[model samples]
Target: MERNFLRRLITAPVAVALVLGLAACGGSASDPGTPGANALSGSDQESTDKYTTEKVIPLEEVDPAQLDLITEGTLRVGTLSDAPPNIFIDETGKFTGFDNELLRAIGKKLDLEVEFASTDFSSLLAQVQNKQFDVGSSSISTTDSRRENIGFTNGYDFGYMAVVTKTDAEIKGFDDIGDGKRIGVVQGTVQDDYATNTLGIEPVRFYDYNTVYSNVRNGQIDAWVAPSQQAEGQVKKGDETVIAESVINTQNFTAYAVNSGNKELLDALNSGLDAVVEDGTWNELVKEWYPEREVPKDWAPGSQAVKLP
Candidate 1:
């Protein structure tokens, strides 16, 4: 009886474990009913359809003054500086990555100055909702529960989940993650949801990508469940960590988060996104940042009305 109880305790959702342990390193809360909570399941259509809007408002229709931005004529974006390729600050001290650059192009279409600020992934959504920033641009995945707290623009990217382990660790992939192996995840991310709610394994949560990846390197954790893009960014040559496996997880399309009440701002950003896609800027950035990644046939960024070139 004691052994079975211990097993059950260990296998409980990560959120529950965090609650019991009073850990500050986890996400806000887990809602199992949220679509795409399980990265291992769902179809491309199922994931992308909800984020697709019927129409995108023209940029000319949006008035920056009426939008109540933190700073007029500027988009104050909250993003992570540690996660590279997608969202990170370059050595030149400029925020220049695929996600930020794409947002900058979108800003150009709207004639708005795009300024970025760094924040923890765990607090970004709430900060956006509270108007600390005009938008959250951390390559956030759209989910139903998240919508209740904040609004999201039409998806600009899809994602893949990966299992990053030390080269010598026995964890080969997602299948090898559970059963008492110490797994690390960045708090408040979909990767956290996958380990906590989908796989039924409590994870050691960290506040940022750098810390979690450090733990994986130092043998403090056996594996790190992370977004494939960020994992690839952190695991460089001479780093003994290897991406054991990665699986396509378009279950949730990644979009920028805005305050749910800010319909005007959301529509305007969506419009700018469509414009970027139309101008070939979107395609150019995709090829530049993710040259090796093959976009799924069924998936493209922007609204349903926009067609990818």
Candidate 2:
């Protein structure tokens, strides 16, 4: 599965843009005491508190043998720890997010313990395909190319690609990003593909999200294109950035992917997902993670109505 960008940015109430000077002026986005400085102290404290108090469903009732897990009693999973609102390593070194929570819930249902192995987003699918991990849950979007090597459960969320720029930048949206504009995108992501193949603009590639936000804030790049939720997370963390409303609204269905031909495990995941949706767990998660948007009523497993290049 291909990686997609954020949705959180699209739903966030627009904050007043901060005026940051150009890169040539030695402006730093990481500078403290500045307006919208990307500070994480508050976020770290909150994450620590949340992880400490959060209650999970008990798993004593379900048996792992029935589910046929990779490690007998454990669900070995692979994911990226930097993607917020989906899966991210908190300041306390614990994985926390909607995706992590959902996977934990699935583990409870299957009567299996979840053991997560963090990897680079670019290598997540390959690891899952090679059976190094039984499943991957990194907000992965089901793509034609990925379907060849992996099997995806029903999509749990929709991810939209967005363009983020410094508040004072002239570029407003995708159309404004001409050849002269330096665009930053995560390497191996759908955003990278879109910037290169669809828009025909070669983007300044970054391996991590923090670098993209820093570059944009420092005026090193004209704009950063990524998942709306991820971009929104960065903005919320005090980055002086603004998400363009005119985004590339690709309806990418994000799902958990298993190795190709692992029909038993795939079926079990789909069943667990169906249970969550039916029991209102899915709705609760959507509200918790994406309070700005309504839960999709017709969403189901393997539902990818809109395809992207």
Candidate 3:
């Protein structure tokens, strides 16, 4: 028997398929049909009341010019192991990636300790609303629907979604996917809605974000709709291929979300993000995680901020 000593990730949501023993955050408790109540209604959320993530960090490494607040301890972050580049256990059994590095710098700057709480991707927003953690550093995109449930900071990074499949699959779009076609996605995600409604396709929802890619690679699932950045990582790890590039919906912004009503926290996040970008730490992290892609010359924190009509 292989000895498995994987620890659960605390910052993001896990897929339903990722076994509890192997999952970073356990699975979400949300009912797909019922959106979670305001954070006040959840029990585990009590940790967030005085919940703070504080640490001392070297801005020079991530951003030297930013206003630094040296806090007392680690910031408890929630996550689901549903996506990579943002969160994942590399083959080396270490939790390291885009979200991890960026959050580390943020914690260092704020002087907060960093702890990750792993859960199901489907349960992330509800957990955030419930105050399950201080922040969600996952690469979550901002959708008006989600904004209605929780507040999102300005986009820290952006990437579109795509459909990955076998090189030989005959899929053009939703019409090509069928009941017999086992599509993979994290339950309660935008990809879930897209596959179920937009594309008019039904998918096999997995527990761990990795299982989708795993099933697809093994020919157990026909395709997977995933974020572009993470898709590449899964492909490289599992030897999969991208069959199509899905475009972003017109109204969404890639962003980090916080519990609603936390204006002070939101302000801090925006301020920290601006400082990161101005001092070039944002660009550096982008280069480190996604060397193949490029940030728009005009892209900056809050540059994408828009007033709802």
How accurate locally, in lDDT, is each candidate?
0.75, 0.62, 0.55
Cα RMSD for predicted model 2: 13.3
TM-scores, each model vs. reference: 0.85, 0.74, 0.70
Task: Give the per-residue lDDT of model 2 (tens digit) for 137-246.
Answer: 87765555556567777666754556799888897775576577899987767666556554556689887787888899999999997777787667764666888742
What does each candidate score in C-alpha RMSD? Answer: 8.5, 13.3, 13.1
Look at candidate 2 and tell me the lDDT of residue 298.
35
Q: How well does candidate 2 score on lDDT at residue 51?
A: 8
Selected candidate, larger TM-score, 1 vs 2? 1
**Candidate 1 per-residue C-alpha lDDT over 1-309 given as tens digits, one digit per residue, 9 for 90 to 100:** 000001111122112211111111112223443332433432322322545787798778878788779999999999999998889989999997899999999998888999999998888888999999999998786666676678889889865567899999998876676657898998888778667765677789899999999999999999999877898789999999899887654345678989989988999999999999988999999899988866656667887788878
Question: Residue 287 lDDT in model 3?
Answer: 81
- The alpha-carbon deviation from the true structure for residue 162 of candidate 2, after best TM-score superposition, in angstroms, is 0.8
The TM-score of predicted model 3 comes to: 0.70
Write model 3 residue lDDT over 16-131, tens digit each, in one string. Answer: 21001111111111232222211111122111111112221223443322322122254567765546777876687666688777766656655556677777776777777777
